[model samples]
Target chain A: MGSKEITYQQIYEENYPKVMRLCMGYTVGNESLAKDLAQETFIKVWQNLEGFRNESGLSTWIYRICVNTCLAEIRRERKKDKNLQIDNLQVSDSVDNATEKEDMLVQLYKCINKLSSTNKAIILLELEGLPQLEISEIMGIKHEAIRTRIHRIKQQLTKCVHNE
Target chain B: MNNFEDLQNKWQNQTTISATEDGFQSLLKSVKFIEQKQRTGNIVLTITIVILVAFLLYVSGYKSATFMLGIGLMICSLVVRIAVELYSLKKLRTINFSKESNTFRSDLTSYYSFRKYTHYVVTPLAVGIYTVGFIILLPLFKATLSNGFYTYIQCSSVVFLMVFSVFLYKQAKSELLKLKQLQLED
Candidate 1:
């Protein structure tokens, strides 16, 4: 294999779980959809590998691509069918039985889905344990603004999850 | 789950889905396929545009006023259509997928709105002029060609226009739907 292919393979292996976790948060815990989004994000990364300028951390670049991909999917789904959101909220077909933890995860996702699309991206990044500054970078908001938004989102998710 | 800290802890503890070797291999193959597909599409579009321009130049030598007028209108319309398509493609390339969410959304909104304008106003105008141009040339074709060939030209033009109209309508509908999607609530 060429050096580029070897490097790309390493990057893909390292980041797949992170990308999948973020995608799951975006897809309302739909594992299949999350997988698809993650796959799409990696496809883009591979395509644009030649243009990677190293201006930002590699993770930051990958997360940005993943976020953009998820946002596009959300827009497409919003226009295509309203019911898909509800369908995604149901236990995914791939999961035969839902554990209590899985149920809570779904409940959390349901709450996250209630936020505005921008907020959804923000909290998903936050949930992935990205620094507030990094979230600000991915979101293109001021760090102060991201911090405040994260606080609000956290409280909102807590209330929504408790209600569920 | 109630406490934010506990939620974070659980999120961190969730088992990571390991990448399968087979999946990675397939992904590499698909990436190669996508690259080839995009390259092919660009080449085909470029070749089509070149052929259309060359055909227009060839017909310009006929020197009849009506022929020139008809061909001129057709070429102008084709130019407008091609310009819009090329501009759209350029705009899409300008959007940086690595940018922050809000900026990316703004860029996409700009791109979609441009498409919405093209679909609603520019495309119909171009198609109408092109159709009229073709019709204007029909009498010339009838005067110059065999009766059988003239009839064949007329029949094929009508079929082509019908098919093109349907394609345009579908494209406009899809663009409108995508524009609606971009209206994200704050």
Candidate 2:
């Protein structure tokens, strides 16, 4: 394959899984919506690829685009479904386990749904094991702020999960 | 038992999902289509404006100075449009897609704010200037509005502009509030 083709394939392979997970978080793990949003994110990344200089890591750039795309989708959906409350959406916290995990995951997603869109983006990226500096660069915030937000997000998540 | 580590552990092992090929393909096609439409629409709009302005100048028989000033304003608008497009391209280049940080959110907020301000504020200001220029040229063409009609049009336009401006301001405020809420949630 040519270099451009190789790069495209690599990007698809490396980022597709994680991007889908991020989309899952934004959609509160709704399978269809997650899939749709993930696809949208990738499409945006592909279209904007020419603008992608090496100022930040390729992954970070992709994540930023994904987050924005997800948020924009959320906003568009909100306009269509005015009665839908972000806070009321159930979050799935299930991991590995089937029966009990489903309930736990649902509760977890509910708390996540309550978070402001940006917070959701931050937590999703952090959960995916992205570094703090990279997150800051993607977010266009100071490194210190990303640190503080991560710390606070953890605290909030703890409180939320406990209440559930 | 409700510790951060426990929650983090569960989240780490969460099920992975993948997007469908159909959706991805469609989105890519849609984006290309939209870009093409916007470019074509802008070109058509520019041509239409040029034709209209030329016709208005011919009818008004305005002094060369006034005609030149109107042309200058149109050129300035075109330049501003190009500059805005370049800035947006630069921003799109700088965006990071993999990392989520507070700064990224803030930068996105700033970028949107700048866009809204230019569209709402600068657009109206340009319209107002053009309106004044139109009024100046109207007299040159012996097409003056009656005194009462002129006053009414001016008052109505002012009121309409004020209402529109207030609406835009409220929308901006709400968007800012949403951004703040997102920040606070973190």
- Cα lDDT for residue B183, model 2? 48
Candidate 1 overall lDDT versus native: 0.81
Residues A1-164, candidate 2, lDDT per residue (tens digit)?
55754465568767887887787778776666777787777766766777788777787788888887886566545433323223423324443445455556666677887787777878877877788887777676788988999999989987988886
Most accurate candidate by TM-score: 1
Candidate 1 lDDT, B113-184, residue by residue in tens: 999999988999999999889989999999999999999999998899999999989988876776776784
Per-prediction RMSD in angstroms?
3.6, 6.2
**Reference-based lDDT, residue B3, model 2:** 81
Candidate 2 reaches a DockQ of 0.37
TM-score of 1: 0.86
Tens digits of per-residue lDDT for model 2 on B1-186? 758666565666665644355544565567668779879977986996788667666746655676557545655554565566567667754655443444555666666666566666765666566556645544533445677776677677678768866876786666655454444543
**Stretches of candidate 2 exceeding 4 Å from the true structure:** A1-6, A30-37, A51-57, A68-97, A116-118, A131-152, B1-16, B60-103, B112-186
**In terms of TM-score, how similar is model 2 to the real structure?**
0.62
Name model 1 segments beyond 4 Å from true.
A79-98, B13-16, B141-159
